[model samples]
Target: MSKLGESLRALRTRGFTPVAARSAARSFKGVLACKKGEISVKLTIYDWNFLSYPHIQVLERQDFLPELMPHVDVAGNLCYFAPGSVTLDRYNPATAILQCLDQATAILDRISLDPHYRVEDIQNEFPAHWEYGQLSLPWQVLLGEIKPNTIKASYFILEIGDKKQALISNTPGEATRLAGALGANFKPSHFQCWILRTKSLPAVPQKMPTTIKELFDWIKIWDHDLYGKVQNILSQRDYLKQSYMPFAIETPVGWLGFGFDLDRIRREAYSRDPKKYRQYLHMKGGSQGLFRMAIKEVSARFVHSRNLSYEDLQNKRVTVVGCGAIGSFVAQALVRLGAGTGERGILKIIDSDKLGPENLGRHALGFPSLFRHKTEALQEELLRQFPHGKIIGIASSAFEYKQLFDADLIIDATGEEAVSELLNGLRLARSSEVPVLHIWIRGNGEAVQALWTDSTGGACYRCLTIPDPNHHRKERFELLKNAPVLRTDGCRAFTPYAVSSPLHASALAIDMICSWLQGSPSPKFRTRSVEGADLYKLRNHDPSKLKSCPACDPT
Candidate 1:
């Protein structure tokens, strides 16, 4: 006997009888019946493979109370497992099949007992079965370019008597002209219109509706009176004819065009119960029928880009002193985190050096940007990736940038003691201090550190470095206290480290900046390195603000 045959025999022992069976190598089909319900269940199992798991589905619909159970869709397909959760063990097909059957039976039994369960009971799994409204629109309508911010516009309805689909036009003039072209009988003034404005992109719905009433319920949750308002607007038009309400939803994924038709809904209600036709007519806000709405999803890149963090980052102005390895990565990371190119936030990159062949392996910019000034190249690269990001690249040293004093936050990635001292002096001299973050990699990428100081009088970058008579200025970390320096043939000595080391340092710097932006208390100094790899076995370090710092005047 085949493995399926043995499984069927086991199921029979558990009070399940096979009404019909099909034996094949490629697939298995059987009609099963159980004492749980008088309904005949057809199970079709596809062959197991790496790409597709071995799973069975009920082909024939069963008589079960709807909307009372989790994992069941409107089509009656029971979701045995969530996607990517687990793979079926083809070797243990019988055990897997029995386990699934047991689970399904338990779920059905629960539904039979409690058909009116709370919707919140299945909140976690609600999104898996959510059904979005059908929306259809022409490509040209969505392709039309508009401004970034919100704008008020009119939605013109184009539906006649009792039609299932309602056409809508965003262009009011085109809608009116089309009405005129149709002839004198079609009065352009009589057409339904809505005054709508672009709203911030909403999150993709987690819990969608399977029934029209469920759709209306979901809409009510978004705006309590919106359903009633939409109904009232539909009522103003001829009830006998198909009327449409314009719904333009800006979601994180894209723009969605939705149409709500009242006439078709009423017709559906009359079809479902002829005796309730009078009741349907007398119902307020057209709540008697299915609240089905059409949605047209348009693919737009920027739709999903605006959120709370993105909005906050948009309002910030940041300056990075060095557009080299660490600075370039930090700048790019900031842009990806919602720092836009213009009014949203300004990202000013300052560096006097040019991108050379030596920098390509460690730097964010590549061959295309070689020989170009580091700031300009990085800015151009960032703009190419994030078109909306407001980035300014200044090919000058941080000392020449006087606007740094006025910035919301300044970052120094120069890895130079002279530059840190200059910024420290400038910060102390100013009455209103701008927050500064200093990031650098130590001991040939074995260690990475980030120091942050804000207007609230935290330890400045100079405080983190003690005046060293032996080696000039040295980090407080014991590992770097007496570290040897490598000499090169030329004036410039190469720092031996991988690309990942600078990136790691950049991430730490970004974390500090984000914490300050969110109004959270962050550590003044932090460091991370691999233990016992290249230097000291210390894995992490977090130093407190210095009490005796000349730069911050901590007496």
Candidate 2:
């Protein structure tokens, strides 16, 4: 089952009723699909209040549930309209209409199967998302569901010029009390009409208003009900009434705030139970840590799953040739994305050069690590970030390296002709079955070439690029060193004028890695660049295949 499906089933296993679970799952699925690049009907949020980015982020983390609260102003600013506040402007017709349509659909779906189903009280769940001033007087299905004995109403505060109007009906005395509770600023003149519904009305009932005070009284009742529901949900979940410490060092980025006391959490977790503490740090956002404290938190829920485990890299050895710009980025991604709670795989780094300022724009090495040899610098950085992994560094040229054939996978980032020739020669010499990913970061930095070879009938570099046949007979060593380079013909320099190309290259390389992991479509073998745009070949393209090509010809 898909992760989402599994999660839905888990929810069902929890206390949620089948109807509630399925209902929530359907809505959550719609939201999840949207997040995963699916398109849907554009939702126009009305003149309701808006939440802060951090709060919105929390919603995103919690799975995008609909919220009910104050409406957003027309300017998209969240408005906390005071009680008994008056406004002649109505909800924006477009957004309010859309919301009503959606609510209507959900209501119909609820009742279509069971005609007797009651529209439960519509609780104002979260803050609103409406534009205030721009929207005119328009009405919407204020509340959705119904339950026995009572019907919930949506209250709207109308503002007109300097005067305010409160619309809703309950009783005159109660309305007067509500207006008085709003403070001295509340004026009777600012008040307008109201809508009141009794038990005798149909579900699609009509609104009957007898007086302004009654409407104001009904508004107060509905507002209080909405607030109660919100509190109920929060209380049920035992969510910390306050947000997580903004400066909590638990999050990777939390260090940006008041500075997290990582040592504190570390010490706390360790002193109690060492193994669990280690798992706490690696469980993602400290879920295990929470469990240690006996707190039922849900921050790091999905980060410790098997699908995300380093199954591909576990117990497998890989060599990353050339600790340069492209090489460092690829290595970092692999380390972070592949390493599990306790890393075990070995990642070997081979490069002879040291870090230089000229390479800073592209290289992952920091300014502090300048002048350090590439292999040593990369190894240190990797070890520092991923203390659990084993990183090996070889500070020597490819040809001089003796252990070239021992690795399981060889990733070639060395943009030198000698390295490629050495790999090809090593494969031929040892009859090595190691798969090689020969990656070439184009000079323009807009694209990268990955020549994947399994040497077991899968495509090899020789099949893609033809080496001169005649030169292999006599001065093979000399010809290999002087072979035609990739930089000469298709090479384009990434001038300082166009620096964004490196970023593009980084993203493409990461995408390739993800695609490879997902077993989806891989990138083209050789991608051509035009004015910095990348294009790839779908099928194998053999430009140098002769009727009797020596290397790839069938025996």
Candidate 3:
């Protein structure tokens, strides 16, 4: 007998009996008794090496109060272990299997008997219940706040692409625009959908409703407000006779949707189609079935801020004033944070430099961008990666464009003391409310520092520096034990730093941006130092204006 088989034998006393192999699947069927009584269990060795989890399932889906069970998928697979929650002992497969089975039964028992636990589990894992499995479609999602006071159903476009996947959208002209941007082909046909929103979760039930009758019944039982809204929308004469009726309902976790082909219900060939329905008495359904459209939310807002407590930059006008090593990372992070997605959202990159062979060693752009204008190449790269992102490149000096300063926020990643001073001079000259976030790496990737300043009055960029007769650049807080080494390749002098520094600098900048978005932008300046570095101590707190600074006065 194999080790897995021998292990199954040890559980015989607990009512496990070896089941004959059906195809490649090996399993032991057993019974586990809890406060809610006994439920059937099947433990299968999914991986002989025990590198992956064992497939544990509850076989008694119909019997033993299945309606109240939580964390059970459509196929009765028990979700006992969340990935990264526990690591399996690869050396001892027998003990690891035992531990997993013990936890599975314990979790199953707890949810089976405890109503409060079941409710919480069901609410937290709502999407699993609505799982569409292999048929899941690529759909655009927006968790854009739907005001509670707004009682009417909103208009949304459902487009089916050439590959037969669908996208749900509220953006005007989004279908054609997105299709072109994504390089996807689509037909002329599209569906109109009305998705009912709710701030509640569905109660644990005997499988997420596989039919239309059960869908309404399930919603009516758990979310009364949403149920009433659905009925009100259904009662409207304008919506009754549509040949194809597609609808959706939102739970707190995510959204699920489907469509009913009202014309197909009468056809015997289409009689068994899950999405076939008949409209009788307008609000009444003479024939009803279920076809689930599992939504995959790909909207910039959802991608960036789904389940996040703080706001994202989806609607913000952001400008990154450099395309050097640090700025490239910042621009990419900004895109992911939704900097250039919404109607008013615009992300502009400004730089005069061209991508050279030397810059590619540590910069985001590689061989493809060689000799291209930094701004134009970066713009192309960002757009290619996120086709929906709105980005503009100004291949010019930061000092030339007055419009560059007019943004919700500006980030300076030049890491040049001269540019910082120039920006500080600009800051002193203007009373604009827009804040400037400055981030840079210090001395051979030893540490990263970020400073956020605005007209609200605190430290400006010049405050961090003083005259350094010994050095070419102004001395700032003396961060390194040894001076940063200057490199020259038969050309102009520049500081040499690795890629990691700029990446860390980018992360620091994003953190500051997040803080600003969160509305309490404190600790305006922060520092993060790497280990084994020749570094001086640094403080992470808002700084007061330097009295000796010449640029702060702007005279």
Best by lDDT: 3
Candidates ranked, most accurate by lDDT first: 3, 1, 2
The digit string of per-residue lDDT tens for model 2 on 485-508 reads: 243223543333133444444455
Q: Indicate the residue-level lDDT of 500 in model 2.
A: 48
C-alpha RMSD in Å of predicted model 1 compared with the true structure: 9.6
Q: Cα RMSD to native, each candidate?
A: 9.6, 23.1, 4.8
Per-candidate TM-scores read 0.66, 0.42, 0.85
- Cα displacement (Å) at residue 282, model 1: 10
Q: Residue 316 of candidate 3: its Cα lDDT?
A: 90
TM-score attained by model 3: 0.85
Q: 1 or 2, which is superior by lDDT? A: 1
Q: Candidate 1 overall Cα lDDT vs. reference?
A: 0.58
Where is model 3 poorest over a 10-residue stretch in terms of lDDT?
Answer: 274-283
Tell me how candidate 3 scores on lDDT.
0.74
In model 1, which runs have C-alpha deviations exceeding 4 angstroms?
Answer: 1-26, 31-56, 67-77, 87-118, 121-224, 232-245, 248-257, 260-312, 341-344, 468-471, 481-491, 534-555
